[model samples]
Target: MARFAISDLHGCRQTFLAALDTIGLNKDDELFLLGDYIDRGPDSKGVIDTIWELERDGYRVQCLKGNHEQMCLDGTKDPNWLPIWLKNGGRETMGSFGDHMPDEQHLQWMEALPHYLETPGYILTHAGLNFRRANPMEDQDAMLWIRRWSQEVDRDWLNGRIIVHGHTPRTLSEIKENLAYLNHLPVMNIDAGCCYDLPGRGNLCVFHLDDQRVTFMPNRDR
Candidate 1:
């Protein structure tokens, strides 16, 4: 089975679908989505709907939690967090819901998402690891929120397993450069800023692990 990974969809539902199509994703393949699935761009609800549809149709999709999802959960519980979350793309997310609110099932699915996943050959997280800790896995907060943690990657702890992650947006060219050196580099960030309509951004990237391929899909959702 082919193992693939992508990150930071950020509410670009149609773009995400296109990426899956571009890769010719099938039931036999495993798709691991590194977080930030919501907030920013449009169709946050639609994005989640696609995830659910994949599951319903027997696709093997694994998801990690992102900082925005955590903020959304907190904002749902406390009025104080509403402003902070709204300021940070929550406004557009709420707009996606329109007349309805996120049902319990959706919230539970997000809440139950793991912060990271470790396979025999790679470690996947929403954000980079905090190598400052004796065991970087102990820092769950950093998994969801940290940035610039690449400089601190504990090579000894990582051993030979490549660290795969997203949440930090890098340009498509930069991502391709990383893919080219996947054999030498210990970490790869696949987020091409699919939702951002700026220079060097706005393309969703898919990383096929076993095949060592990169699939690019433009943002037509926005």
Candidate 2:
């Protein structure tokens, strides 16, 4: 079975589907969505529903919370959080949920998502983990939202598994050539900024863990 990781969907339902099609996913394949599923696009609801459906159909789908999702959850607890979230394409996310605000079910689902997922070879996170934090659990904020600090920190801080993260969009995928000794790991950034229009069209990154093959589906006219 093939295993894959992707991130920063940003509500592009068509592109998301297209990416899956390009990857030729099978029933046994596992897909890890590195969060930011909703926001910045016209079909946030469709995106969420599609993922839920995929999971129901026996596809091994794992989801993690992104900063956007955190903002959505926080908005429910504090009115002030709404503006910041909305400004960052959160209005679309809210629209996806319809007139109904987040209820217990939604909160429970969001809260249940882990900040980081670890496997023998890779660690998946929305944002890179804080290198300085001795324990990942001790710093949930940085785990879900850190950017510069995570990138600038020495790679030696990463422990064991290769850290695969999305956030801090880059023009191209970054694969570190060297590994630091802390945990003997390298960090990789795969968010190709699919929602933003620049350099190239929207991209959905696909990684084949077993084969070590990485490919991307560029934004195409729908």
Candidate 3:
């Protein structure tokens, strides 16, 4: 059985599917979706539907919560949060739920997602770990939206495990500078900016843990 991880799908259904196909995933392969599954694209509904379908098919899919998902949850608590969520590509998410409306089941699923996950050799989060906290387990905010914290080098954190993250989109090469060390354990960023253009192309990254390989799938956008 193989294990793989992906991040920041951002409702790019085609790209998401393309990545899965490119990776040649099997029923036994475990897929870790590093959050941001919805928003900023034309097919948020499709993204959710596909994820749900994948789960039903016996795929061991682990999904984390992203900042966008947090905004959505906050919107339910405070009506004022709607504007901010909408401004940040929430329109697509809203459109996806069209007429269906948010339900208890959906809310529960979003609410249940953890801020971070620890596997045997990797730690997964939407953003990165908090450096200020005396203990990494104590900080929730840092897991949802941290850039500077992940960039810093700490031998303790490095020796802990590989940190796989999204949120800050940069090329695989670009991540080299953001990382604290080059020779030691490395941080892997899978965002690749499928929602926005920096490298001017929408792309999805696939990391095959067992094989120690990285694969890329071009977004359907261009």
Q: Judged by TM-score, which candidate is best?
A: 1
Best by lDDT: 1
For residues 117-187, could you state the per-residue lDDT of candidate 3 as single tens digits? Answer: 87877888889887666677678888888886655646585575777888888775664343435346457
User: What residue pairs are clashing in model 1?
Assistant: none
Judge candidate 1 at residue 119 and give its lDDT: 70
Give the distance in Å from residue 197's predicted Cα in candidate 3 to where it truly belongs. 3.5
Model 1 C-alpha lDDT per residue in residues 1-222, reported as the tens digit of each score: 889998988889999998888888999999999888888879888899999899999999999999989998998899999889889888888888883446687789889999999876899999888988888889999999888877677777888889999888899889988888876668899889998998999999888888677888989796
Ranking by lDDT: 1, 3, 2
Question: Scored by CA lDDT, what does every candidate get?
Answer: 0.87, 0.74, 0.77
Q: Any runs in candidate 2 off by more than 4 Å, and if so which?
A: 98-104, 150-160, 173-185, 220-222
My TM-score estimates for the predictions, one after another, are 0.95, 0.86, 0.89
Clashes of 2: 0
| Residue pairs in candidate 3 whose N, alpha carbon or C atoms collide under 3 angstroms | none
**TM-score quality measure for candidate 1:** 0.95
Clashing pairs in 2: none
Kindly list the per-residue Cα lDDT of model 2 for residues 49-96, writing each as its tens digit.
788889898888999998887887888789999888888988777676
lDDT of residue 58 for candidate 2: 84
